[model samples]
Target: MTYFILQFLNGLQIGAIYALVALGYTMVYGIIKLINFAHGEIMMTAAYFIYFFMTLLDLPYFLAVILAIVFSVVLGVLIERIAYRRLRNASRLSALITAIAVSLFLQTLYAILFTPDPRAFPLTASSFPVLEIGEITLSSWTLITIVVAVIVMILLQLFVTRHKAGKAMLVVSEDLKGAYLMGIKVDRIVSMTFAIGSALAAIAAALYIVSYPQITPYMGALPGIKAFIAAVLGGIGLIPGAMLGGFLLGLVETMTRAYIPSSVAQLSEGIVFVILILVLLLKPAGLLGKSEREKV
Candidate 1:
């Protein structure tokens, strides 16, 4: 029972990180029909910014996080304006290829500038306190991860449902032409969506690095892919669905690794994809997503 509880907490921690990243994925997809494959690269860029701000500039952790998030928001908006805006009227395939290209470009640029070497993150698991209750032990990181994710989710829900700018985003998502005709700045709303998503990714980047305590130019790739899968599993465009999917994926992956023999524990990742396949086959619209027919 103690072991089970321990793994559950671990799952929540991992899920929290995935949820944060998936929120950005879902928000961008909800607003624009694009997948934004470079979104993960934005997270990577933010992590690098944090690394440099703390290591080179000797800034405080909280200040470094704020700066990194701001930089990432700018980067996301720039990517939308420079790479995606022109392709808005273009074919989906063209936009997809461009997203891939942008992701590759960022990866290459980071590799060149920072080198491909993995560096130790300034913070480590030991940096946080651990608590014990009877036979169960809890890490401060775990509590912080789950708490922060929940708070962010609540705040985002309020923003979407209560704020005027957020309402404009909904209008733009539902009908771009109608939004434009209604005097809503569609472009600005889209940029704002990217900005918000990038900020979430930046926060996730900080938490993830602190947990894993390692950094590399391509560090965001796998986690980013998994988060995208989580978004899809939860119904890609639904905010709550993204959170649910992340938690499910994290729990499943953690349990699989925990129970499976060490020799085949590597199969945990493959199992995650298998679960996704099963879910999609059973519910094509996703767990919480409703199916919609496209106009001919």
Candidate 2:
């Protein structure tokens, strides 16, 4: 039972990361109806930027994180302007293909520049502290990750609910045409959404590197895919739903790994796919998603 509890905590920590990344996917999709498949690469680029700053410039960790996030935000805005803006009126297939091409281009760039080798982030002394409660043991890093994730989520909720820009984002997401009709500056809102989401992904990447230490060009691929799945499972375009989906998926994955046989442990991902199919079959719009009604 203690082991189970510990595993649950671990799962929650991982879920928090997924939730952060998933938010990027959901928010972009919500506002622009674009999947932004290159989001993971944006995250990877941010991580690499931080690493370069730390190694080449000898910057502090916190400063590196901030700069990385800012860099990612700028990159996101640029991509939206240069790539997505052109395709806004084009077919959805065109936007999707462009996104995929961008994703591959970034991945290839990283592989060429970073050698596809796993690089270790500079680990501070605080990286590996352990904590114990009763019979359960947990890492300090895990606790920190969960706390940070919660705080970020709260800030995001508050922004979306209370801030003017955030309200604009909500309006755009709910009805882009209506928002445009209301003089909402739809293009600016979409750019802001991408910037905010990419910034979150950068933070998630930094935290992930803190926990795992070793990172490669492809490190973001699996996590990004899983986070996208979580967004879909929870209901794309719903912020709270994305969070719940990420945590639930994390718990399910962890539990499956813990209790299932070793031979079948490899199939945990498959299990998640099965669950996704079931969810889609039962609720095509997702757990918290509302059905879209077409105008006759």
Best by TM-score: 1
- Write down the lDDT of every candidate, Cα atoms only: 0.89, 0.89
User: What residue pairs clash in candidate 2, if any at all?
Assistant: none
TM-score of 2: 0.96
Candidate 2 ranges beyond 4 A from true positions: 124-126
Clashing pairs in 1: none
Clashes of 2: 0
What is the C-alpha lDDT profile of model 1 across 1-296, one tens digit per residue?
A: 99999999888889988988998989888877888889889889999999999999999878999999999999999999999999999999999999989999999999999999998889876788998989998888888888988898889889988999988887887888899999999899999999999999999998888888778879888888889889988998888899998888888888888988989877776987887788789886778899889777
In model 1, where do residues sit more than 4 Å from their true spots?
none
Model 2: per-residue Cα lDDT over 29-141, one tens digit each: 99989898999888888889889889999999889999999999999899889899999999999999999988888898899988999998896325678788898777788
lDDT of 1: 0.89
